[model samples]
Target: MEVGVWWTRFRAVLAFSDAVVVLGAAACVPLLGGARDPWPVLLAAAAAWWVALGVGGSRDQRYLGVGQEEYKRLVSVTVHLIGVVALVALLLRTDAPRPYLTTAAPVGAAALLLTRWGWRQWLHARRRHDPTWSHRVLLVGNGATVDHLSRQLASRAHLGYHVVCTWEVTSAHEVDIAETARALVRLARRNEADVIAVTTSDALSSELLRRLGWLLEGTGLQLVVVPGLLAVAGPRVHTRPIAGLHLLCIEEPTFTGATRVAKRVFDVAAAGAALVALSPALLAIALAVRTTSPGPVFYSQTRIGKHGRPFRMVKFRTMSTDADHRRAELLTANELDGPMFKMRDDPRVTPVGRWLRRYSLDELPQLFNVLLGRMSLVGPRPPLPDEVRRYAKDTRRRLLVTPGLTGLWQISGRSNLSWSDGVALDLQYVENWSFTTDLVILWKTARVVVAGTGAY
Candidate 1:
């Protein structure tokens, strides 16, 4: 574990920068409206903006450089300041000067965001190898939750937290209220923590939580309780107190409506344009495949789809006509344990076929499936029928969405990933699918395919 000293220090910079930008924006009001004697009004408005930013928690160290908290503060301050400006303009009946007052909102918001991005870039560059870079927090749970938290942070260290130490006892489902409280108190005291992250699994009793909450009240240290919010991003974690009990109102997963329509529209539009753009190349590939081997140019096989439907997924053929019958000969050479088949240099591939598969040009024919709505332009790869057949009940949850031409697994390490790892990635993608995420994956896919990294 380490410290978020940089992140915390950056918060102060953001706060102070926010104040300056507010002052700068307010100053612009007079110049834009051509008001020579507007200094008094500008100063008052600037002062109010600074006060509003502080009140909106833009400078809170607790939210530094993590999740959407920083962004929320940025937005909240902007809206509040704009409200103040609007109220002033309305009171003064300044119709022609309205646009002048509006200038502060976007200008201040952009300034704050730009400042944060620049600071983050500097932080990431300077602290890549620094020992005390990220937040070093005491992880106060003994079981799977702690294990998961530690592994996740370790995997993506730049997200910036180190587990440092895990303090005390059994599984997440074991309940021992008083003893756990004692354990929690001792661990917090021993760690000299700047932050105490309580991973409250079912095992940690509410009494223990309350006890720890009470014991740490006056320590001037940060306390955080993390419920098992699953793959839902941090922005979704909202607490609503109903009848004095804090009820966390987690939003439901909805993959339908405008977003879905947009994705499909993008899919069809892109796929159609690609086919038109690559018409000659596609024809040449087809002719090359037919001449190089006796088999068909394109291949179609049954694959599992959304909601457990079976569909014939299409791809350019990359092996001999009877290669499926020759599988037994290569069975002993298989590198993977589970059902999916992959080898770096399989002898069954023809010269042209090998080149096609190497660059993933062979999978380009899946564009047809995407256009047909049988597959997505970006999503989890359509699992083979046999592959889905072997899936454990939980693993099949990914089939809840249409399989994709490219996905998280494709960009991560394709055929190189183990079966368990592949499913884990697919599930993560399904759970966290968003338009931006899809766009990022599509961009990364080009690089991965070009390099032929981990491709068979």
Candidate 2:
């Protein structure tokens, strides 16, 4: 089947699921002591919520199978649904029960998000086995950009982009604008591609891009221009049309103001709560580390935090007391590249330490670091002073925000991640930091910890 047909069917499934959830929530309102003859209020609320989800671009094809934008739209729509419900009640002079509105909003939103997540999993699973479910992408650009973009897309098959072919235009002088555009169209047709993704290239001028769009008119092929910038999130970018030219406006991420305050507050509150909740486990781990190894239960190491500030980062001792003494001997056997030292089976690691590190239980003591304002619940990994010294200028951006106990680096393959890959993930997180993104990362961290595939 065509990718469009599959997407359309998936969207319909989402709409139907949403309708069922909304109606189901409305039906339960009367039981919750809602308006007596709640039929009118219930039906109106259900109809409005369902329609709002549809028209609000909650299920837009662009965000259907990838990224957090779809979930963001769902959240925005749900928030607006509340305002619309209240406004309607005021205008109609109906005594819409507060309980019903409150109940419906949260319940409906949760159910909708849950269903969407489940459906996304299903779509990803299907796409992995059968490429027909994904968008066949034709990449056009300079060789370097094409290579980078292709690798990224191919690595994440869940994103639903399958690269079919590439047209590498080395320079603007080598290719005529009209000829390039026509060649892209013919190439896309030959490959049966659904999308033409033109990566950043001087060979593709604005006029040529515009001409390509003109030529693609009524051709049912999607045109996407990939910017040169890397690791940028949708929230940080805005596009506007002025004087018939599209201008891309990129927003710089700010680490100050109310958002920073909110983040600090969240880190403190969450870290405190986590410590309280996991107190019993923490004690057990400390006891295990002390009894299993002839060393102190905790290890403290100087790590670079925000702005290159050094702090003693604490963790449950996951190595023998002589681990540091033996480090010089194993330095040559380091499994990971760059400044970080990681050995899958180092002789200095105690048996208990190995278990703790496997599931990252050793990092639990970092909750104290988070409380102490020396680290964050989520951000880039706290770098070693040696690692910081070796960092390139671009890599120093990790210090712009407080270091994290667990971050994209931790959740994304942890020790298994190549140093460059880990650095890229950290940079991406630094640029796209958000409360919602943090919540998502924390949730994923739980799953990753349990799997323990990437941990040493």
Candidate 3:
């Protein structure tokens, strides 16, 4: 907590929130004082609040720049402190000031949440403007996993992790750590990396992974595992401690029960609402497509849907009429692969098509797909039949769920990622399907769409 690496931006958020709590507590002392004298009690409560935050890992630098993990811990600590005060008041049998206590509870909670949001705003601004503050990371993994993870980390600037260099091991397959620890130490020094990420897969020796943990304990460098290199999503994998050994269990991707119902509800509500709200914009896009070129307003293509069924995915026509017929000729200039073609500066695209693709307005009609139950509001990207043939056995699992208008692939660089990456992302999405991850992906999709990056 004191010495390890934390995303500096995250640290700033925690620091600001902590300050708010302290200041709020101080402000309440005057109004909340009991008639007899409440100075001691107030001081003690304030002290307990700070101490609990410390014990809860709320101040740990490791969590500073990461995602919701830090906020979860902060909430946990805050709730415990509030509970302690509630219990003490109940036991003492003294009438506490109801107004101050009641007001403070809600106010403090609101402040905590609001401060985190505000801090995030500031952090994002800093990331855009400040170059020196980039997160310095030392990636450690064997062959393929290392390369994949590095690229993933490199592209997500908002996540703030910068891959300075890597400790190249045998690969994600062989986890022999006999020489891995020494290797990590050398790499960390060479790269001046602040953190060490171990992405070795489960096929390797677990003991070696554990020993690498020991090797890192005294190094003052942060240690994090990729959790699942061959798989995706943290929730799909769980750890259990039985008989002094830690066993990792990875469950299959199956959204059922209440989860499935909630997803359907969200999809319908989102898609239904979006279609109704965007009707004017949709009509405008159609008119633009019709007026911009001599072609139909809508472009429809056969894409593989859930369980390997074919469905017509519709978009506003962005390319020339001959674009589809001449796809083969354009494959030579393909910038993206894996059974599909993506040309960065496709000569086939009409000027309007290029602009339409930029902001993803062309995909707005997919709301109809989502409404028809042929696709989801969020899931894996619907692929072409030719693309489906190339999927490895594990990658085929992505078809279990409804296809998506904007998926992990769409949210993360879309046409920019490589062939192997497309498969990995699909498998990861299938394996780690969760309502929360889906929400995050949707939120990220907004940013990617606005940036219009990798659109071609």
lDDT (Cα) of model 3: 0.74
- Tell me the lDDT of model 3 at 49: 67
What would the C-alpha RMSD of candidate 3 be, to one decimal place?
5.1
Query: Which residue segments of model 2 deviate by more than 4 Å?
Result: 36-48, 96-100, 240-244
Better of 1 and 3 by TM-score: 3
Question: lDDT tens digits, residues 10-74, model 1?
Answer: 66777677777878876766667644445776677678777777788867766655555776787
- Candidate 2's TM-score reads 0.93
lDDT of each: 0.76, 0.88, 0.74
| Order of models, best TM-score first | 2, 3, 1
Q: Score candidate 2 by lDDT.
A: 0.88
Candidate achieving the largest lDDT: 2
Candidates 1 and 2 compared by TM-score, better number: 2
Q: Per-residue alpha-carbon lDDT of model 3 for 1-456, expressed as tens digits?
A: 122223554665576567667557545646564233366755565566666777888767655545787678767877776677677778898557343356555566567666766666666666555534556678866668888888666666556677888766664454446676777777787777767777755544677667767877876677777766355456667789999987887777775778978998899999999998989999888888899899899989999998999999998899999987899887788776566777787888888888989899888999898888889988888888888898778778888888898888887668888877876787778777888888989888998999889886
Q: Mark the regions of model 3 whose C-alpha exceeds 4 Å error after superposition.
A: 1-13, 21-52, 81-111, 117-230, 390-392
In model 1, pairs of residues that clash are 1-164, 2-136, 3-134
Better of 2 and 3 by lDDT: 2
Per-residue alpha-carbon lDDT of candidate 2 for residues 337-398, written as tens digits (9 for 90 to 100): 88889998888888998988899899999999999999999999888888889989999999
In Å, residue 214's CA in model 2 sits off its true spot by 1.5
